[model samples]
Target: MASQAPSRVGKTLIALIKIGLYLFVLALVALVVAVSVAVSQLPSYQELVRRDDLGQMIRVRAADGSVIHSMGPSFGEWLSHDEIPAIMRDAMIAVEDRRFHYHPGVDPIGIARGIWVGWTRDDRVRGVSTIAQQLARNIFLTNDRSMGRKIREGILALALERRFSKEQVLELYLNRVYFGGGAYGIDAASRRFFGHSATELNAGQAAIIAGLVKAPSNYSPTADAEAARARANIVLQLMVREGAISEAQARAANPQQVEFVRTAERHNSARYFTDWVLPQLETLIDETVQPIDVWTTLDVGLQRAADEALNANAPSAQAQGALVSLDRDGAVRALVGGRDYVDSIYNRATQATRQPGSAFKLFVYLAALETGYTPTSTVVDEPVTINGWSPRNDNGRYQGPVSLRAALALSINTVAVRIAQDVGTRTVADMAQRFGITTRVDTNPSMALGTSEVRLIDLTRAYASVAQRGVAVVPYGIRRVTTADGTLLYQHRSDESRVLVAPWVAAQMTDLLQAAVMTGTGRAAQLGRPTAGKTGTTSSNKDGWFVGFSSGLTTGVWYGRDDNRALPGLAGGRAPARAFHQYMARAVANRPVENFEIEVALPDWQVEPDAESWYGAPDDYQLVDPDGNPIQPVEDGPPPPPQPREPGSATTEELNQEWLDHAIGRNRAPQAVPQERRGPPPDRGPPPRRQQQEVMPPLPGQRQSAPPVVRPTETPPPTIRPRAPGTAE
Candidate 1:
């Protein structure tokens, strides 16, 4: 019975062993079938080789091909196996798969070892993928960690080894592998780390690049230089252990210094211009599959200068400043949106809209010139009220009468309003639109004083129009775009048109503005060459601008707080003008010196008003004495001798015709002025209140004097300017 029991136990053990063997065989067969099906669904080897579809970078280049900016996915230049350094390949093989050449794509021994390690350590940290297996997974599968995925990876690996040579597989692997920081392919990885081609990689650089295959971002030189060096040391040790490199070579290569290129994030000096270019990419290039290079009109030197100028002056205003420099052709040479682009990429130059203040007076004055109003035209500068709004000079004291040129140079608010009122506000707005002021402008009287908001670029373009002799300035940055292989994508065409202002008118406007810089509020922006522009300060100094241009470059600078908070004593002639001067100094340093095209006009300092008689008041309507001082007031009853105008021949009939024609049109001819008095006529209104007031203090940067008190018996009431929050008046 004992013998029979032993035989029965043996028989049972045998039967159990047989059953386990059959089940193992069945599971193995099922795995093979599943892997075969997955492999069949995989793309063919030829299809993978021929696939050119890859996300490439959109590189923005300066005129000299220097990289200004880059966007989109990274697909750097591909390198064949032969092109890749042997040291790099050997280091990669040693660190990733020790028995790469000996194995049939999937190493059973390696898998068993990995399994044993995982079982003993209770952590599946080790991977048993050969180079072929890694290539298969990288090319044909997602990074899934399931058993099914592992089986499919192994099957694909075997298929890859069967269909392609070992060199071919390695080449494909090196070309498509990700190496962190938007770098794909060994060439990109090499260039990104060493700033050179993979073929030229040294032993240390090669080892470091090869070590990134396991963890690219974790060991990137830019992100973690210490980790990258440690990884390279490990790769060197592994190479020695696998007999891929000699011990002496590994020892020498372990401590080798690696020089890494600057990270992409560090090269963001041109972010303001590049941000402007990002939206334009869609219009320039429809497809992003292929690599594209855009040649922009940006001059990097000028861009650097602009940035430095803005940064240096930012502390004064304690606010951000934006600058845009354009060539005579309206090509944007340099653009700096704010002090620091990385801190905030709002692109204030192109996007932010703020009131231009007196800078917008350019349009009003230009309109006046177009209507036969010379720069020497004179107008009363006394306090005026229009639509219940009273506008005062910056000094709170009017100059009584000043020339149009002097009014513009002095930034006389009342004079601009009077002119706009004379030639309908609508006409001023139309003239502004003709030049590149695209922002909405209210036709109110305040619009003449730059009450409307506008973009800095648009205002800069408007100034460029005057600088370019009345040519419509369309500010553009992109010059041309082409593929990496020279496929033409886009080229800018000249769409410039003639603005409403004639050349002579624009030249006169330029001459008037030049006087502004030479002696007016923009004296701070004076360049040795002929330069012209206007200064602007919004209410409460919320926005300060210096939009001026040399014969070669037109630049507009805006200094203000992001939240529209007022800056105390911040005027366009201060920080913004200084910055404009600094930037323009550099922008035109190399260019030829060109004076503005002006017809030897009268000097800005010359002041001679037409001296003549007026309506019934007196024969002489003298405001300023021969010495240019306001005449003192007299007693109440006796009328003082009339003040004579400055030296100029005055025509009685022609001078009186204007007031009489206007009075006839309005049916309110002043009965005070004698009908027979053949002389210059006074405005229709009662005498002003006789009150002695001293000259008030000037604005931050200005000089002024008290005006002569005119007691007209028949003069129209002057219109007053409206006051808004933050207004200088």
Candidate 2:
């Protein structure tokens, strides 16, 4: 029985051995078939080497040729294997793949070690991909975890090893890897992180860049410098172990001391200007033109100045501000869309349309000037009603009669409406459009008060046209566009500037604006030079604006809450004007003092009354005695037949005092006196009827009558100065 049991066990052992041999043969056949299929489905490695799949890139440069921004994947110039620094190559290989030179596509030792560690630890497996395999996966394969993708990756890696030299494969890997911040390739990464080309990278910078390959965002210096530095120290130790650098060199390499070129926060404002300019690029050049260089008109210095000014003068935490600066030819030199572009990228300068307030009066006054109204033309500033809507002055009180220049300078709402009424609102709307206001302007009476919405950029450009002396200005940002190789794709060619207003009219308007900045509401915007601008305050202080020009530069500033809520106590002459002053003070510090060509003469009606003359009488004439009694003349012949006074002939002192009274809130109507006296009241039969006299002809669309008062007793009559040839008195 024992012999029979031994025979049975031997027979069973032999059958199990035959079964194991058949199973091994079957598995080997399946493995060979899978390898063959993966190889057959592999993409062309030659195409991957060329790297033609990278999308287009756009580089925006400032006027001084400094790179302001870059969009899309940024790649540095392709470097040959010899041009790459030896230290950089060694740092990368020591950290990424230590056996890169010895491995032929697949490293069996590395794979075995990775599998053993993963099995023993019972954790996620670590990658054992060599440089060639990584390159193949990046170029020709998806990152799927399926066995099919790994099979394809291994096959392509083997093909690359057979076709290219080891140095060529390493070069390809260095150029194809991403190091964060939109940079691809070692050269770009070096420039992005260190602000220099790869040729200038030292040991510490090379270590930092090499460490980024493991997890770019996690080790990005810009995002977390401490973590990146710690990772780089590991790479430095690896380099020392690989004999690429001595231990003393590794110890001396201070990755913590490495300074980044610029943080994202430092260049965020430039992004606002570039964002505004980028949309215009597509319209300026062909869409298919890949890798373009847009040379914009932005002056980085001026842009920084503007940013500083806005930050310093922004009214409150809730209040936002925008600024737009343009050359006389309408090149956008600086544009700040908001107080903080990171918080909101709405681009208030070029995109948001808000009521410009009294700033739109520039167009209305320009229209009036073109319609034959001189700066000294007479206009009534009393309360005016149009279609049941009455516009009031900033101060509740009104200056009864003011010159066009003073009216505009003071931003008198009723005066603007009256002038618009005389010139026709359509003319004002057309004038605004001609001056480069792109938004639609309402033709209602309130349009003169700038109730229509307008972009800050368009308003600034409109003022620029006036600064250019009647020449039309089309605002532009891009000065030139070129390909990556400096081939010109598009260049801005200014067309012959069309004449929007007569030069003399522009000069007259400029004179009015100068008066605004010199002695009126825009006084805060004065740069101690010949400045021309206007102050604008909307209803309830919802918006404030200051658009002005000096030294051949026109800048406009706006301050308001983004939610359209009123800023308590906000006015155009306040924060906006101060910001304008601060920005212009820095922007034109180096520019030579330039003066506007103000050739228009003041109207005869605006002539100052002689200091010695009493009641506008001749020097020899006398009206009253020092005791307040009328001095009867020796021989007065019917008072010399009542001389006619010119329109708007109020003495300069009286007009100035009236303006002062209105500004100081002292413009109250005279109080009626009681008939009762301290002693006995004098008995009066009746009040005498008021006598009227025709003093001057009516203004363009309204009448003017002298206030009924007793004339000077027996004094020489006032003389009439002949009006100028083209005067609108």
Candidate 3:
């Protein structure tokens, strides 16, 4: 019986051996088929290396030539084996594949260890990909985890090893692997994260980059810096254990010292600006261009300021604010489209159009000045029905028979409507268009009160024209576009600006606007400099605006709810003006103080009956002397003798008459009149006794002085007038 049992056992063992052998052969056949198919479909090594299918990469740079954003795969200069730092290579090899130098394309030891650990731990299998295998998968295959994909990856890795040396394989792997933040290759990753070249990377920086190969987004420093640093520490430990780096060296490599080129917050803040400029690239460059660099007019510092101010000063949690800043030449310096770009990408500054309210009064008053109405011209602020629609003052009270300067300073809706009725709303619309308001303007009388919807960018550009002294302004962002190889594709050219408004008319409008900021609703926008701007508030407080210029920078701010719901008490003088002040305070901190060119003299009439002048008491106003100092008070005594008037010198009344005659097409030829006539009369002497007595009053301890003399050659600085009590918009 024992002999029979032995024989049966031997037979069962042979049968088991035969079944095992057959299964092994069947698996071998399947692997062969998969490898053969993968080989047949594999691209040539040259094709994989060329990477011709990569998407067009766009790098947007600020005016200061710093990279602000990148779209699509970002690749840096191709680095050779010797060009790559030894620390980077060692870190990569130690963490990615310890036996990379001694193993074939497939690492049996790594695979076996990974399988045993995964089985014993009851977890998902750990990655056992060698550098060559990773390179093959990245360049030529998908990241599928099926057995078929594994066989193909192995075959492709073996083929790559056969075609290239170990050094070449490592170089290709390091140069072609993906890092986070749209970056590919070690060079791009280094420059993107460290703002430098790959050759300058230290051990910690190298380790940080090396750890990204397993999962790019999961360990991105910009996204989750703590996790990234932790992964980097693991890489350093691996390098130390691999004998590639000493323990002390690993300890010396601090991941905290690695500073990113840009903070995550700054990057997100600039995204709005970049997104606005990106779509313009297709029109600026040829469609066939593969990769290009766009140089924009964005000032990073000003952009930061704008973002901070808008976010910090937004009136309400539900409201959104937009800011647009431009240089005198109309180059966009800073733009913030919305409160938070991530929550919503709707760019309120450039895309959203809202009612400008009284801010639209600029066009109405500018049209009036062009038609010969001086700042001191009388305009009655009375209740009047126009087509059954009555436009009342914002404060529900009107100053009867107010001067144009006072009317605008107080933002009186009735006076603006009266002036618009006389000047014609079509003329007002045309004047606005001529000054760079691209939006459609209504011809209705309510347009005088800014009922017409307009974009913040267009409104801001119009103000820039005034700042530029009547020169047309075309707001532009892209300064230049170039190919990756530095071939110029597009360069912005400053075309000869056509005069839209007469320089003298612009100066007069500026004078009125300066008064508005000094003693009116815009008093909150004071910058301790010669600033001129206007305040606007739509009905029900749905929209608020402050648009002004100082130090050659023109900025506009808009605040409102995106849903167009009314904010109970919001006004342009409150949130929007404060934001404008905050941003311009930082933007023009280093700029030299510049005075507005006031060619025409302010009227002798009191701008506001009860309000004091910016400098002092209403009757104590004095002009700056030839040396730019305020005229000092003299002891009570006889006034100085009046100086003789110069030849061709005319009184304020004569200049107004001439302007009216020119507007009405009188016999005098328009071109025959000199442009100098539009300015103050040739710095003539003081006015006559009657005019002096009416315009100037004696100080408490001194006698009366001559009326303020404005030299035609010297531009006068704007005054920071006090806000009148009981005045609100």
CA deviation > 4 Å runs, candidate 1: 1-54, 123-125, 264-268, 315-317, 498-500, 599-726
Which digits, one per residue and each the tens of the lDDT, describe model 3 over residues 653-706?
Answer: 222334444434454654565332232222342222112212212212222342
Task: For model 2, give the 10-residue run with minimal summed lDDT.
Answer: 673-682
Candidate 2's residue-wise lDDT over 53-81, tens digit each? 56778899999998888888888867778
TM-score of candidate 3 relative to the true fold: 0.69
Q: Against the hidden true structure, what lDDT does model 1 obtain?
A: 0.76
Which one is best on lDDT?
3
| TM-score to native of every candidate shown | 0.78, 0.75, 0.69
lDDT of 1 by residue, 1-729 (tens): 778999999999999999999999998898677666755776765666433444667888986779877676456566777778888889888888878888878899999999999988987846799989988887767898898888788888887776677888888888777887677888878777778788887778888888888898798887898899999998888888888888888777764467677766643558889888768878766866677888999998889899899888774645988999989888999998888767787889999988889999999888777654566556668765565566677877778767778899989888887777666688889998888787898887788888899999999998898888777888888888888789898889866555545565687798889989999999999888888888998888888999998867899999999998888878988989999999999888888888888653322111221112111235445444344555433445743445655578532232233433443343344454332121111231111211223232222222245344222112332343344523452
Q: Name the weakest run of 10 consecutive residues (lDDT summed) in model 3.
A: 710-719
Ranking by TM-score: 1, 2, 3
Best model per TM-score: 1
Each model's lDDT: 0.76, 0.78, 0.78
RMSD of 2: 18.2
lDDT of 3 at 218: 92
